[model samples]
Target: MDKFKKVQDVIASVEADVTKFYEGGNAAAGTRVRKAMQDLKVLAQEIRAEITDKKNSAK
Candidate 1:
């Protein structure tokens, strides 16, 4: 759950950069967006693993 929250926070944190990159054409913001996306991918993988672990344990 904490990792899930971190996922949400990452998404929220990236929103400004996403907007800046798309609407304002900021290259730095686009870089940040890319980094944030990488972070999101890692976090998602972790969450998926955690869920699988929990499910297996419950059964």
Candidate 2:
């Protein structure tokens, strides 16, 4: 749940930048959006690993 909230927070933080990049044609915002995407990837991987570990432990 904590990691899920973190993922949501990351997306929320970048929502404006995503709009600026696509709708307003801002290069800097695009850069920020890219970084946020990378962060999201890492967070997603971490959550995957956590779930795997917990499931395996429960079995």
Candidate 3:
């Protein structure tokens, strides 16, 4: 649940940065968006692994 919350927070921040970049074309904001995307990808992988582990344990 904590990890899910963290992923949600990162997603929200990325959405904000993307909006900022699109609104004013800020290069810094674009960079931040990219970094946030990388973080999101990592978090997604972690969640996937956790789910897989849980399923295997259940079986």
Candidate 4:
């Protein structure tokens, strides 16, 4: 559950960065957005694995 919140926070940050980059063409914001996207990918995978493990254990 904490990991889920962290992932949500990162996604919000990425959204902000993307909006900032589009509004002002900031290279730094673009870089941050890219990094956040990569982080999101990893976090999503981790959550997926955790859910699968829980589901299998329930059986």
TM-score (all chains, Cα) for each model: 0.94, 0.97, 0.89, 0.87
By descending lDDT, how would the candidates be arranged?
Answer: 2, 1, 4, 3
Roughly what TM-score does model 1 have, to 2 decimal places?
0.94
Q: Where does the lowest 10-residue lDDT sum fall in candidate 2? A: 1-10
lDDT of 1 at 5: 95
Error of 1 at 38 (Å): 0.4
Number of the top lDDT candidate: 2
After superposition on all CA atoms, what RMSD does each candidate show versus the true structure? Answer: 0.7, 0.5, 1.1, 1.2
Clashes of 2: 0
Clashes by residue pair, model 4 = none
Q: Give the count of colliding residue pairs in each prediction.
A: 0, 0, 0, 0
Worst 10 residues of 3 by lDDT: 11-20
Residue pairs with backbone atoms closer than 3 Å in model 2 (clashes): none
lDDT of 1: 0.97
TM-score of model 2 (CA atoms)? 0.97
Decide which is better by lDDT, 2 or 4.
2
For candidate 1, write residues 1-59 as lDDT tens digits: 89999999999999999999999999999999999999999999999999999999999
Off by over 4 Å in 3: none
